[model samples]
Target: MNHTRDKESILQLYNKVLPKLAERIYQNLTEVTPLFDDFRLEKIVDTWTKDRNASTDKEISIENGNVQQLGLKLSLIGFQAAGAQTFDLSKDLLFSLDYSYYEVGPDKNSRWMEKPYFEEWTSKELDDIAVKWSEEVIDEITQKLQGL
Candidate 1:
């Protein structure tokens, strides 16, 4: 009978709950994901070095979500060898999580259910995300190598 009152109640509910929902989403995205870990960077570096005749003792240090090459160099046929180059490979590794709110119109009101549902991501999906991030790191390394 009172449409304005119903909309006010919905807005009030969204205002009360959205911040916590956003925080939980951010924590779940960043804390559990291995995207910024050293192991991930090592995997990327390993993949890159696997094709090249690079040394086995490639060292990497990730501090505060920043990937720092301890002492790595590339000596390709055309490019001269640059000794002990430290690359800030974290540029591509930087990530942020975002969430948005949408108001359903009368025509689209039936599209979603009354309750919101969240499904835990499968291992395969997580692996796929990791692969994407690995590619980003590889691209950054390749660009740095080209500049040398």
Candidate 2:
């Protein structure tokens, strides 16, 4: 296998491969994100009146993606005690994960750029999902590039 030739092929693969992979990852993440039904809704609102439902939703997206990099954003609204009333930890939260990829021999590799900015503010399930996403990116990319 010629090194330069392999490089060119990998470059070509990026345009064809990354966008599809990104879409799948985005969908996988959004499907499992929480709606905050488990949160303490009773304490947050004036429960003395009627049923105060603590509604929440996630704003998830594949922010950017190309040959060398991919970025993802996850924002939670109405998931906390404050229920979007303020920007503090007791309210809403947001974070981003970035992955960079490269070719090594006939395989591709990916890694997250850094720990999420609001990692400590998030739940264990969310942390696990983020880790899974990073691992899935490298595994899937490697499988796709194995033939090249």
Per-prediction TM-score to the true structure, in the order listed: 0.30, 0.26
Which pairs clash (backbone N, Cα, C closer than 3 Å) in model 1?
none
Per-residue alpha-carbon lDDT of model 1 for 26-110, expressed as tens digits? 3433532333223221111112212132344443212111121111121112222346244343322211110122221112222
lDDT of 2 by residue, 1-148 (tens): 2122123333333333333333444455453234333322110111122112313232221221112222232333333323232221121111111232232111123332234222222344444444565455445434534533
Q: Which residue segments of model 2 deviate by more than 4 Å?
A: 5-7, 32-131, 134-148
